[model samples]
Target: MTDRLPYWRLSGFYLFYFALLGATAPFFGLYFAHLGFSPERIGELLAIPMLMRCVAPNLWGWLGDVSGRRLAIVRFGALCTLLSFALIFVERSFAWLALVMALHAFFWHAVLPQFEVITLAHLREQAARYSQLRLWGSVGFILAVSGLGMLFERLGMQAWPWAIVAIMSGILLASLWVPNAQPEARSDRRARGGFIRQLRQPGVLAFFACVALMQLSHGPYYTFMSIHLEALGYGRGVIGLLWSLGVLAEILLFMVMSKVLARFSLRAILSASFVIAVVRWLLLGHLADELAILLLAQLMHAATFGAFHVASIHFIQRSFAAGQQGQGQALYATLSGIGGALGALYAGYSWTRLGPSWTFALASLAALVAAVIIATRLSEERA
Candidate 1:
């Protein structure tokens, strides 16, 4: 198994999958705004896909576990994601956009968590190596954001859908090539029997709660940072550079993640991530026009996303037995979904009512609360 990692196949899937994310996440809201959607309406539109995350991963995970056909699910999900997104060219009405977002995301959200399990299965004992492969995702994101940022600068957001369609098509094709693999065995009968008992364990719920809150704080950034910068008078090309810069920070951190994981406890990493996130949000909210400060804040993506994600996934890998990995990953995605949906909905309302400054202040508060929860409730183990 170690000798047969299928490195390019797995990495290609991640590259193209996140490439699709790169095209959409940074520019999608801007496109919607160009089409005359208000902040609240755009928020509603963005939230639909996140709302799908609440159910899609678990449903697909169940199918994979029951049928032992994880790759089949990935291929099907990718194809459907492409098909649903292709409909965007036919209409731009708010209702049509909402339906498309939900339709595409239902399958899109399922691919990653299940693929994470497959990747970990392939890595077996060398779990730290997971970052090496996953970093290509950050690279893909950087390429998409930076390149498309420049393209959209000249051609306008009207070109956005075509870029996304091309990337989504790439994802569908890549999914067809990844070979299926199973996680290694474990002796926990509870995975097959008492699933509820696993949920009630020490730190599990607390960890998930913290993760949800962290993502909730990201609502404004994920949904509106591009628009936010544009409102601050930055060009789309610069906006793309800012977005790519954040992912670039994440990519660099991933390069060193194995060393960082070996040295620091997961508790330390998570706690620091939450704390830094609080500062990052505050800076983005109040100091966005200051290029130096904005750059500094974006670099904090290393802590906010890079460290937080690596730690959380490692924690999940350690906590769940082999048979339960699917459900565990699904729960993570679901909780993240719930947080993201609420965050987007709240940010939508808040951006109109509270304005960007206070809205981001609220986001900082969310991260602070998450940090406090982690400090007190979570253990200091080196997961």
Candidate 2:
């Protein structure tokens, strides 16, 4: 089964998908700033895409599940994303850019959740290997962040939109190479219950609540970290290296994740991730000027996003039936979007008033709450 897996094809899709993310996450806010937008405006513009995530994934997920056409959805979503993002070239006005962000993000967000379902379906009984495939996304992130960091430094930020369009074209091309897969049908009676019933299960709501909090805590980092680093006098190249260092750590963790999963309970991994997030945010908020401390905090991405994300995916696969996997993944994306939107909005409002330290302190508080929720409500055993 491992031998037959469309390893590179699947990996290629993830590579481009997250290459888009790598291009966007660390630099988009900076791009907004480059356009002379205020922090509040930048946050608002950035939040629009995240807010769309709250709506888009569940909608696309439902369409994929009902149609059993996950790959078609992925391809169409990719096409729409590319077309919509190209609108960025038309206008740089606040109103037009806002519309562009919302449009591109609506379709862009649609691609990943459905594609995740597709990837897992392809993995079948070898689902534990998910991290290996997903690690390529981190690789893509490293390349984009590190390479483009230098590119932008040389060419100036005007090139950002063009670079993203080119990468998104790659995403569309990659989607064409991968074969579609459906979740294997199950005979287990538990699957007979509807999706809502699955949601009401013990620890399920709590798990989702934590998901929102985790992503919410990330709001400041994603929305302003580049700007924040720039304020601290870091060069674009160093900033890119710092961002890539986090994903590089994530890649290393993915390489060893199967063994880690075997040794630790999902609950434990999740709780520790939240705890690390609490620490990581504080370090970023208070100590970012210290390169050594910043590096340590960046390494914690291995746990905050890397381990935590893998654990959450496994939890969903276990908690939901095969028939419900699309919606399950959709709901995960939806919650993440909700948390991220709120996080961005709040970070936007707070950043100018309370300053970066306090902004990240609020993020730490969110992670602390998540750690507590997971500790008390999540199952000690694997879901």
Candidate 3:
């Protein structure tokens, strides 16, 4: 144990963290709707937390990077999550619910980007091991979705607040003991400047742009998929299992991500993921009546989310010079945050007017665009 890097312990951290997110993300919409909120209102309320992510991570990440107190920032974020979500019990009115959601989400969004830096720091040369560690997060998501879905089926949507509270508390506990992410060594001034300079390059900007669109396309799925399923008369527990099935597929991909990356180019993986994302959303759009196809669509989550995410991380690492790592990740978080917030906001508008099929078709188009952007423009790897 002493001789080996504690990658497994680090994986445990993500497992708990994302398990909490899985519980929080998919069910929160159903819970609010059960509280007598209308669709538009639910959209507004759901979007609040994501909107907070736009700035929360950038602010906290800058602090974490500059102060070199990454663990402290993570701990503070967790503590705020523990405190903020407690307001849910007191929040009865729509305005109060919005406030509580925003507060908790701000804190929640702060943790992951910094945590990625931590994980990367821990696994420097053996970073392929990241997939192995990250797969547990998918497992956690599966279990949370499957279990909470069942609990909701029997107990009603009111059970959500309790489930979320338990998961966040677990995240808080795990975060407390996990060590901070420390750069193995700081870069000298010249290296740092050159690294930051890459942000201005067309290739890097194009890459980040593609990533932003990819996350944007996920907004509808993130905010309204549960509502859509419920409206279609799917049982809460079954819906949960369906959500878990997607993450289970993601888990399978992550389990083998090391091998996949070894064999394929990042651009190839990313392009393929986007292509699958296009098909997946289309299936969700037109084939909503077909159970087997819907299941197949769910499984494509492995490529759409899992491979794309891993590719993004590796690309950022490869794209930026060493000194610029913290900033690079911060930028990625910033784009994802802003893109997600905007996507959800628009999806809300589309839900009533264009309906699910049109809404998802738009999402598929976004992925197709992302594929065009990456496949054509990504610069050849430097010698």
Candidate 4:
């Protein structure tokens, strides 16, 4: 069955897409700090992409669904992302870099949700196989984070933007190789409810609410984990390995996701993820100075992000009809963006005043809240 799918091409796009994230997420804040930016400034700058994510995905997603041109949108967005990111080399001012971050992310943020729609369309009934393809993205992330960590240690941080540009080029190339896929046609009876109605269904809104909270809890980790490690005297190379270790755990979970899904209900998986996130953040906040404890926290990435994400995707696929797939995925990105932006902003403000321990404690509080909401509001059965 997998033989006929555009498996490699679709996976290639995910690989490069996440490779860019691997480069930026772990190192971008460090790069800003290298330029003597304050934690507040670094947080604001990093949040720009998440802010763009709040708007871009919905706009492009609507266009893709209405026009049946998802692949075209993906290709065009990739091109614009690469082009806008290149402007970083021309200026170093906070204002100029802010503009570049917003511009590039506006396009880069739009690409993935649309591509997710395309991939799901291609998957059709073989949806369980999604992790098989998506595991390669984890592979890409591990490569970029680990490789660049060592490279930066040797050559200095000046190489950061150049490495990103090179990877963004690969994203563009991968986008070109993926074929287009139209959403499967549905009977009038099946399509009658429309996007808004589906969203109003039981557990749907709560699921989205929890998603926002989950990403919000992730804000400090994504925004400052590397910086935190560096302050603790971990080298850039070791910090990168720590980051890769989390994603490596994620990849291992992805390998068995189908079996996991078969045995566990989505609600069970999601709730457990949130519960794990609470512990992960607390450990990160307080015990990070202890390497073994920190490693345990990183390994929990399997539940925090890996299982949670796969469950979210499955939930979205099951909740919406074929025609509404693009919007469903876009809303997921949008809510996540909203949560992520708020998280970064709060972490920035608190990192200095409240300090790392308190900031991550706040994150743990957010996850605890999400766990409560999901446990009660989410349906026991799959949507």
State each candidate's clash count. 0, 0, 0, 0
Model 3 spans with C-alpha error above 4 angstroms: 186-195, 321-323
Each prediction's whole-model lDDT (CA): 0.89, 0.94, 0.83, 0.93
Clashing pairs in 1: none
Considering only N, C-alpha and C atoms within 3 Å, which residue pairs clash in candidate 2?
none
Evaluation by TM-score, superior candidate among 2 and 3? 2
Please give the ranking of all candidate structures by lDDT, highest first, separated by commas.
Answer: 2, 4, 1, 3
Candidate order (TM-score) = 2, 4, 1, 3
Query: What is the TM-score of each predicted model, taking all chains together?
Result: 0.97, 0.99, 0.95, 0.98
Runs in model 2 with CA error above 4 Å? Answer: none
What lDDT tens digits, residue by residue, belong to model 4 across residues 210-294? 9999999999999999999999999999999999999999999999999999999999999999999999999999999999999
Tens-place lDDT per residue, model 2, 1-383, is 47769999999999999999999999999899999999999999989998998899999988988989999999999999999999998989999999999999999988999999999998988988999999999999999999999999999999999999999999999999999899988775547678999899889999999999999999999999999999999999999999999999999999999999999999999999999999999999999999999999999999999999999999999998888888999999999999999999999999999999999999999999999999999888744
For model 3 the TM-score comes to 0.95
**Model 3 C-alpha lDDT per residue in residues 1-383, reported as the tens digit of each score:** 12456666677778889898789778877888888877678778877877787788778867876787777778889889989999999957998988898899889888888888888887777877788888888889988989988988889888788888888888888887786657566554435546557776656888888878998889889988898887777888889989998999998899899999999888889899989999998998888667899899999999999999998888877666544566678788878877787778888888899999999999999999999998898765521
lDDT of 1 by residue, 147-206 (tens): 999999899889998899899888888888888899877666546554457777778899
Displacement of the residue 170 alpha carbon in candidate 2, Å: 0.5
